[model samples]
Target: MKGAPRMPQDDADAPRFARRVGILVTGIVAVSFWIVTLLGALAVVTRFVRTIVVPRAKRTEPVRVRDVDLARGEIEFDADGDSRTPGRYSFWFDDDEGHARVGDITGGGAVTVTRRIIGVDFGDLRGVSRGRLGSWFHLAPGEFGHPYSDVTIETERGPAPAWLIPAAEPTDRWVVMVHGWGGRRPECLRAVETFHRAGYTCLIVSYRNDGEAPDSADGRYGLGDTEWRDVESALLFAGEHGAGGVVLAGWSMGGAISLQTVLRSGHAASVTGIVLDSPAVDWHDILAFQGTLNRLPEPITRTVVRTLGNGWGRTISGLATPIDFARLDVLGQADRLRVPIHILHSRDDGFVPHNGSARLAALRPDIVSYDEWGVARHARLWNYDSDRWDRSVSGWLTGLEG
Candidate 1:
């Protein structure tokens, strides 16, 4: 090796080779890092999708009942955001065996709050330790003084339970009410009396994957995609039962389902108007807002949305059919809406953002009557101010009649 006198070229080649190796090693490490990051993001997105599609079987009771003074018409609860929030709320205890209405925070401390108990609908509240607070103040239509009959609407999945409350004065107009995500027929009972007073028969329906309705094949929520079909069946039932004109009233995700029903159903011609409360106008918007609320990274939210929209993601999302987000976007297709829409959304909605509703109202003011509220939480506008809710809805119904 020493036979050749040290050449300049040979020394130059040594550094060049070292540089190539360095570049190659750095490239490999960067690629590996990206791969690991992608895998972690995918894992997070999978869990998020599961929660969105999977139906929850049990309701969580986070409000603890510290004491119940029935004689004094008062109830004390361990103070929390929901328990301390103003306005009336329903308390369900012992697997929903007991239900009571609590109104107005009478007194409050750092760790406890006592509310005036309006009345106990059922079950003894004496020894109840804990319960769930909700907006379902009325358990059934009868609670609001309307006689209702249990009827079944035959859907593609099976018979779905519904509450049929006929109008006191005979009228062919019907208002088919749909509840929000994970809600039952009782959630729609608050709006029944108003519709009944306006001479509209109220039909509160339960769609598939909701506890009251028959389960779909996948036992998952379609997030208004497939659930709309069940609502279509309800519309057909209403049409068969002499519904001359129909109004579709929905809350939260139910609004999404109602939007889809009107756009996709053959029976859409029968729908003369729509009423929405705290609606999920766009699933993409809702999911993005939720992702941000949960502190998820932006890329993770985008990837989750892409996965939900692609066929290859079915394995991860557990969806039988890849969701078509473009089709579910009501804002994108506002021009297609023919019926009058009355949207009542609260600025303080914690669950679903009201911006989409505001945008929709701005876009289609001709057909949309947006009644914006200041303090009502999601789907609880009636609970917050029943007089205003009734006036708005009744006025809207009167406009439709005129």
Candidate 2:
């Protein structure tokens, strides 16, 4: 009876039972691990969605600083009169003043504020830490709208413009040259000499910060803000000095401003042609380049730019001359151009890409003629191959005249 009761199933059965227990334990451990990992992932995603993604979108807004067009000093009316202080633009007002064509004030800063005025600023404006205090724009000497230009224009604060007319019979055809940041009229001398010999009268202009001109506001450089107006004034001077038609030629940032002056939509009837060398199309894009060159990306670039760049116009140039990247800006309108344009750039330009000129030609085949050479960085193509440069530009202009 004892022997019958004690019958073990088998050694094989014992081993099989152990194997089943091991499989169950392994399955449980795997399931537990996966569940823990899923919870961790959800936590990370929630933080990302809430902290980084949601706040940026929610806080973003389009800037809207109202422009209050004041009457010219001769007028005594309240139509656009502002008495914030003497000449400085006021930034205290918050409401959008409908469409009153007021003096332009661009705004932005590191702190939270409803409005900010950039180009020119008075201490009266609220929500602004500081604003630029200087001339809004510069005026050049030239006669505009006249059959020819042969006069001098005195800037608002400066002496009469110096016109270094070539020592020859005054020529009706003109090439008005504008230079870039830290550059003076002398910077365009190389190109000017060729044009001078080609029988084209050349006039080099001085902007707010060039050739004895006063310092810019905020002590910083604007790629093109107030400088564009200087070019406009210069164009008018050219017309007065007996220039039958105007040829605007600029280098680097000056090139960009020259284009803006000519392409100023509602008024481009006077300009005969345009020449830009290594011009930047979008300033914001340039800043992006600055970031990349420094190896900063995404949120860091966005943050630093948002923080320091907000006050850039106000602090850096010592002139709060805010440059609106919008505003019928020339770079935006490669098409819709009815006039002739010749762009010169280099493949090795360090500051601006040759592709900008290329893009312009691609956009407006009829108006734009692009030249991206292989040597001489930035606007120095002429120095690299002076003969070629002179021939290309001088020939193009002569052909146009004929």
Q: Which stretches of candidate 1 lie over 4 Å from their true place?
A: 1-40, 109-111, 127-129
Q: Over the stretch 300-390, how does candidate 1's per-residue lDDT look in tens digits? A: 8898889888999889988888888888989999999999999999988888999999999999999999999988888999988888999
lDDT of model number 2:
0.55
lDDT of 2 by residue, 260-315 (tens): 77666233566788877777765556556655765655554444334333455233
| Candidate 2, run of 10 with poorest lDDT | 73-82
Query: What is candidate 2's CA lDDT for residue 227?
Result: 58
Q: TM-score of each candidate?
A: 0.88, 0.57
Q: What's the lDDT of the predicted structure labeled candidate 1?
A: 0.90
lDDT of each: 0.90, 0.55
